[model samples]
Target chain A: MAEAFLRRHTPELFGLATLLVCVLGFEALIRGGVVNRYIIPPPSDILLAFERVIVEENILARCRDTAFEMLVAGGASVLVGVPIGVLLYRSALWRRAMEDWIGALAAAPIVLAFPLFLVLFGRSPKTIIVMGFVHGLAPIILKTVEGLASTRPVLINVGRSLKMTQSQMFWKILLPSAMPIIFTGIRLSWTFVLITIVGIEYLINLGGVGQLINELAERYDLPGTYAGICFVILVSVLFFLALERVESWLQPGR
Target chain B: MSISEKTSLAQEPALVVDDVVKRFGRGTEIVTAVDHVSFTVRQGEFVSVIGPSGCGKSTLFNIIGGLLSDYEGAVKIGEERISAPHPAVGMVFQEESTFPWRTVIDNVAFPLELQGVAKSERMDRAHHFIDMVGLASFEKAFPSQLSGGMKQRVSIARILVSQPKILLMDEPFAALDEQTRLLLGDKITQIQQELNQTTLLITHNLTEAVQLSDRIVVMTYRPGQVKRIVDINLPRPRTSDVVGSDAFGHYVAEIWNDLREEASRGMADSESAASRRATHG
Candidate 1:
């Protein structure tokens, strides 16, 4: 009975225990003067700073800004990449010619092209959104093509033998068959979009949590900087939980 | 009138494969899979096509089912030449083709859904076929949640719900164990007899063919052509126990007699290919 309970609540119990250890260790290290408090604030100080950032600094508004950028980038990646992927799947010539190039593009230093994006979009939110979208698109496109191409020939034969139209075949058979892999692509794209969004905000001093962290570091407010970093963690956790919910909704009993 | 008499009244050819020749490769290296294959399946008749491995029995099946349109000659259903898939023909493949996402009834109702049938009506129709296949209790079960034989039953129900005149089954029970194969074979025979479905089965198991078919068409080795047409006039309402009878054993032997040489020749070719690979590798 105890083992079953432990197994059932293992993640929550372990996560909290590890978190407590880290927090207490950090506090003890600071009090014992083993580490410089100016550089690494104790967890309690960071938590106090977190309260100040939430109440005084109004971090929620900046969170909304970051979220808006991510949504635009993530949405654009799906809209643009899926069609390109479908085209690649449909045309063998195009796929043969460009498949390797797509693989290369995914690993390319796409964010290094942010200056070009700035010039194109005039140093606005559009620049960061565009950077995030472009950086996220390659994985989505490659995965979609692979997903569609790797659909079982038997399923396609079933669709054809049932007298399904090309459109019907795509919607009823191909899309559903490719859904799990496509969802993987979407999740990967979300990761890339999240990273690009924060990185662009940090580099350009855009108005978001990354920019807040930069400002707090410049001001020598170590605790506030740690608090801002925590907000970043918060953002990541929110994204993960939201994706998990959507995944469960889309593929029940998976 | 009895069931056989009523079936004979509609004595039209349900499916006709006319001099169909399927080949692969280009230039001088071209190889024929099926050569000059001609046969007719009368309405409400059950025919089994048995052949050695790679004898193009499946290729012949694909041609008749409108999956391979590039083959030579024509396949016809009734009087119309078949170049594309028609609603009157349904196929159960050797592979597990049930969509893993859908439940038993949904997979079975898929064909009707494609025809724009209403949800309630299609469900009702699908339920009837599910019950016929003894899968009524599994109406809400996913394909992944079923046994191999049960999955095939779902595939069969899916095909039958379309109410096709011709049922093309390609080695549908080849993946199952011997016991499951025998039980499922008997269930298939019962369903076919009950519905009087016009079915053409491609199988390597001679006993299965003898148990289920009215006539078995045996094919030769590669570049397959009909080597013999063996009539199995066994008793009606055959069950799994029919295989124990002397008549079933005789029919099985007769098919084996025609098939033995072709099977050995195929084995010899494969052995030589393996030896060539072994030497080269």
Candidate 2:
């Protein structure tokens, strides 16, 4: 029974053990003065700093603010992106005219447009949300178009054989068939949205864990700075987990 | 009138495919797929159209099932001429067609749902057909969970639930193994006999065609044209058990001889086309 348990969890056990060794090794290096403690604090110091930062810097509020911005930006992107995708799929002329432009938009440095957004929406969370929304929109639209376009011809023929109307075909067959790909687009969209939101927060020092990290870095509090960055990593992990849950819920078969 | 007279009157033609000519491309690049093919399926009859690959059997099927509209053909079910999908015709496709997102019962009930049948009524009918296809307990199972043969059975049940006047199958069992094909063929035969259904099957497998069909329409190679229609004089209510009989072997041999010539001609045509491309290149 013990052997079976170890066999089932070998990768996880090995990964955790490796992580512990690395942390202990780094701590010893810092204590032995081989590495500069001023620049790279020991893992123990970073862990100790977590409690201080969480209590004093109001880390939970920062996390909540970042999560809220992510939620709003992600939701808006999906609401606007999916319909645009369906539109592009339905209209070949529109798709031919706009598809290249959308591709260009996806490749462009969308974060650089933060100043324009600040001028338009002002120095607030609104600016950050809008930037994230713009950054995330293109992938959702493109993936939606691709997903709908890639539905198998045989499946369409099945719908045609049943004498399904155009609207019925879109609703019953095309949309459901395109869903897995569309979910891929949504996951990608969320990643971009999260990066944009946190980056904008750090850049302007307005809200969220990005602002907290900027403040700690300026104060030269190495342990606190690293702790703030850890919170950012935590936020990303949380969003990823949430997205996976929703995806599985939506597509139980997969 | 007596019961015999009424039974004779009921044996009228259910489906007619007259002079179907489907051509692809335009002008200099023109290629004809199906060429003026004609056949009729009577009520309560099983007909198979057999041929080599690329013989436009699929094109003919698409036209009959109303998937392809740019064909010069008249496909009639009962008194109505069909250029588009008709309510009286149901088609079973060759590929994996059971919608991955739906359970077996839901997939089977899709047509009835489209026709605005009540949920309870459609579910009951779907259950009946699912049971008929030997997938009774698997009604709640998704397409992803089933094997290839089981998925095909789900599709079969889906088509059967609609209860159309005629069932048009396009190489439906061509993807299965020999044993699964024979077993499914037997199940299909049983269903047809039980329902007294009119069916038109498009296949390249001579054994499958001979096993399931009351009459076989053999077609030539590309630019597919009907070469002959051989009547199967085998007894009714037949199953795969008759496959070992001498008559079944003779029928298979006869169809194989007819198909062997066309298959070779098809191979030759492809070979020459390849050589022509290689020379030009």
Candidate 3:
């Protein structure tokens, strides 16, 4: 087991180690005046500024704003996308009719349409959050559809032979079998959420970590900006890691 | 003494398919998958369906198993007209049947759980069948962790936990190696003898059909219809050593001869389609 773990994760460990070395090297270069802090914030200054931000600012409020958006996006997409995916699967005619549209939405950049959305919804956090949801939702729907479509024919036959009701088949066979891919779509969903939230904050000035970064950068507080970036990176990594752990825990043998 | 008087859950032919027909698609492309197929599976009998691919043996199996209801005519389990999945009918399909998310124990226990059996009780019952199929050590392992034979075993164990009056197996060991096939075949025969549950297995392997079945039903190619049903007088507890025996060889020859003309006709049709596609392309 230990050997298997080492083999599976040696590259990840190498990456983390490499990142730590780069961070320390950057810090040393900045402190030694080999490079100016104007070029990039020193790690020490960034850490100190982050500590101050935590102590002074309502970091929780900003966090809550971002988190609330993510929650709303995740919950609403899971509810709406799963059924749409299943519906597309249950009928071939409906699947063919909607499939091209789903594929188009999944491929197109909903983020680029933010200006139009702002014109319609105005400059509000609700708009930012909904934009994040819209950006994140297409993949969830597509992946859920792909997952359901790709589930083994044998499992479907089992559902049929067992005389499982359509609902029972959904709850028992189709949904559970589709979960891994669907969750992967969910796992990938975070990427779009992070991008949408950060982009919106820069554009609309809603106070999230993204907005805080923008505000700090505007005031020439490079350290605060870097620190805010660090937090975003940390949260995104941790959020995905938490999701990975849950997916593995639910999947037997892992 | 009479067929009707003899019909019951415990002793009657557990599943009966009478003049059942199944067609795929419609209009000019209407393909009759199963054509007027009829069969009776006596309670505790191990009957096998043997035919070439596209012969609609699987379709017939599905009809009896109640997987497809869009077909014509009737299928009855004991005294009732079968229209839905009855828990008393357990099915073990090929290797892909086991759910990847479920452990060996949970996969086997699923039908029981759906039946509302308590978790602890279900696990206990599941473990017993798991042990019976020689998967005792891998109870907590997932389907991904198991080999193909092991996965099929888990499927078998799962089906048995329900103690269904009949077990419908669709080429359950076709994916496994020859050795595993022999072993699993013996295990299935043993289980049937012990439980005395009616069983109908559908397969194309003539040797496998010969070894595992007391009677074999052969079908023609597409627009498949039952060609002949041959009974084997071989004694029980069949092993791999029995494969080359005179009785086994005789059964194999009989089935091969019956299928030869259908096989040739199927090939001719296939060549014609290929020629058409070549011309069209």
Q: What is the lDDT of every predicted structure here?
A: 0.89, 0.92, 0.82
Q: B1-281 in candidate 3: lDDT tens per residue?
A: 77666655444667888898899997998999999999888877889988888899888777777777788988887578777767778888864688888889988998887778899999899989999989899988888888998888888888899888889888998878898898888888778787876888999888888898878898999989999999987887666678869988988998899989888888898999999999999
DockQ-derived CAPRI band for the predicted complex in model 3: medium
Report DockQ per prediction, comma-separated.
Answer: 0.60, 0.77, 0.52
Query: Residue B240 CA error for candidate 3 (Å)?
Result: 2.5
Q: Which stretches of candidate 1 lie over 4 Å from their true place?
A: A1-41, B1-10
Regions of model 3 farther than 4 Å from truth: A1-9, A20-65, A83-124, B1-12, B25-28
Q: Which of 1 and 3 is ahead in TM-score?
A: 1
The model with the greater TM-score, 2 or 3, is 2
lDDT of 3 by residue, A48-70 (tens): 88776677655556766776777
TM-score of 1: 0.93
Rank by lDDT (best first): 2, 1, 3
lDDT of 1 by residue, A30-148 (tens): 98999889879888999889788888778878887888898899889999999999999999999999989988888887878888888889777899898999888989999999999
- Report the C-alpha displacement of residue A56, candidate 1, in angstroms: 2.5
Better of 1 and 3 by lDDT: 1
- What value does DockQ give for candidate 2? 0.77
Candidate No. with top TM-score: 2
